[model samples]
Target: MGCSNNWCELYGSHTSLCGCFVAIVLHGNKYITNHKGQTKPTVLLDCLAQWGIEKIFCIIVDNATANTCALRKFQSSFSLLSNEAFVMDGEFMHIRCAAHITNLIVNDGLAEVDENVSTIRNAVGYVRSSTPRLRSFELWIDSGKLTRGNFPLDVKTRWNSTYLMLSKALEFRLAFDKMEAEDMLYNDYFMEFEGGAQDGGRGHDCYNPEESDGVE
Candidate 1:
């Protein structure tokens, strides 16, 4: 459950410890069931019914195997909420969440590439290990480094800081160039990172999804 202001402290803490838990009963938190590949429709149905949500306007979901299974289960449960509605409103429709489908496609495509790119990535790591070694390369950068319209030896890496670093550097390029000339800007990890917090680019899973829910 996501919390308010003191969110950092509440994160990773037990649910009971949360001061307040927002319950988006329709399609918010996902409860992976104990039974494998067996998401029950009644889980959400019972919760929504208990919350007194009658007249059943709509339900939203993402594209996941478990989610779709739960949706089908929910559809059947909604139909059976009353025998009269079961026979009358037989064509009850479920609206799939578009944000979910895109996530699945992106996940599948990236997984395929990650397996192939592992070795090349490892080789790059072996080359950039020591701070002093990386510093020594700056001399060569003056002769062969690719530069922008301004000057050479312009290696801009995030190392997981926000893009603000690059933005700030662009803003004060003159000062930074002077610092580089004075033998500053010398962190090996800053030049290359494992795409972690210290490295700021989007390695994966930064986009919104498209599919609503998946089929059982």
Candidate 2:
């Protein structure tokens, strides 16, 4: 019986606490156990022992040092019990979270285009930061016959948010260009930004202007 445990946060009316949960799947049946603790190896071991789980095939967890240590300690303890349930000497016990790995890879890739992203983010922020600017942007959208929508600010910690911001920005590209031409404030800000970039020896547009124009 291979079982896995992971820590989760729980919120209550009065307080929040961290706890561990254990789950086992075999023959289409799943068993679960929950315990309160900091997800240390000893707490995990105690939880499993309380559940009378002597045979553990493996545990799947994120790539955390505490989880690795816990798995090692659990494997050692199981070995001492001479339990045959331990597979591959617990070599394949620790499974890293695939989603976490993907997020890391995506974030790393996004960093390559961070300058362009920051530019768009700043532009969106400027538009949405004030009621007057948002109303002006809406008027620009109407005049340009562009799609009516709001500019979304991206969350710095979320890659998907950046994606949404870029997607929406592309959809409203004409309106943004119209604002640059007609709105002195918007025009001055971009001009100053470009000047700063040039002075810093990074004289590049936030994104390729031609490419932005070509997007249908």
Candidate 3:
């Protein structure tokens, strides 16, 4: 029986704690269940014990305080059982979630390139905010004879969305450059708002049309 605590907001109002349970094994069918309660160590242990899963070999969970405490208490109980059903010493039962670790690593690396990412994100937002700007961008694409593709806007909170936005924006770098040079409204908008309080004074100097071809 593997369990983990997940906190979620209901209807964007009330916050609730939920415990996710999963039966994992090398063979046979597996099932998952969810229980809502306090994420204390004793509560989690009681939930597992009620499921008749006493001979647990190991518990895989993220490196949370409650989970670590639960596992420490659970190890003592498992040691008391005389039957040799449990494998290993249960000392190294808790395994940190790999996906969480990878997210941490990727987010850390993203911090180094945040300024460049923000520049691209803001440029995309600028073009997408108005119908005339979007139309102007489409016209630039046609003028350049470039294959048309949708320009995806990204959610700031999600790193993968930012990556996709940058990837898609790179394909239309020429179009963006052309629009910046030829479209009067586009230039005026940037001059007025690019370094203003609305955009936190992030200037358009970072997105030079001349350097668009070499932007990474």
Write one digit per residue (lDDT tens) for candidate 1, span 1-216.
322211212223211111111222223454434322334455545545654443343344544566556656666666666654322253433445544465555445545544322322222232244445344543444434322322212122212122222232333334333433543333233345655534422211121223211110
Better of 1 and 3 by lDDT: 3
Q: Give the per-residue lDDT of model 3 (tens digit) for 64-154.
A: 5655666566566656754542445544456665655665666677777677777767777878887666776778665442222466787
The candidate, 1 or 3, that scores higher on TM-score is: 3
Candidate 2 residue spans exceeding 4 A from truth: 1-39, 49-52, 64-70, 73-82, 85-88, 142-151, 188-216
RMSD of 2: 10.0
Q: List the candidates ranked by lDDT, beginning with the highest.
A: 2, 3, 1
Top of the candidates by lDDT? 2
* lDDT for position 72 in model 1: 66
Per-residue alpha-carbon lDDT of candidate 2 for residues 155-198, written as tens digits (9 for 90 to 100):
77667777777777766667777887788887566556454463
Candidate 1 vs candidate 2: the lDDT winner is: 2
Of 1 and 2, the candidate ahead on TM-score is 2
List lDDT for all candidates, in order. Answer: 0.37, 0.58, 0.55
Could you tell me the lDDT of residue 98 within candidate 2? 67
lDDT of 3: 0.55
Model 1 TM-score on a 0 to 1 scale = 0.37
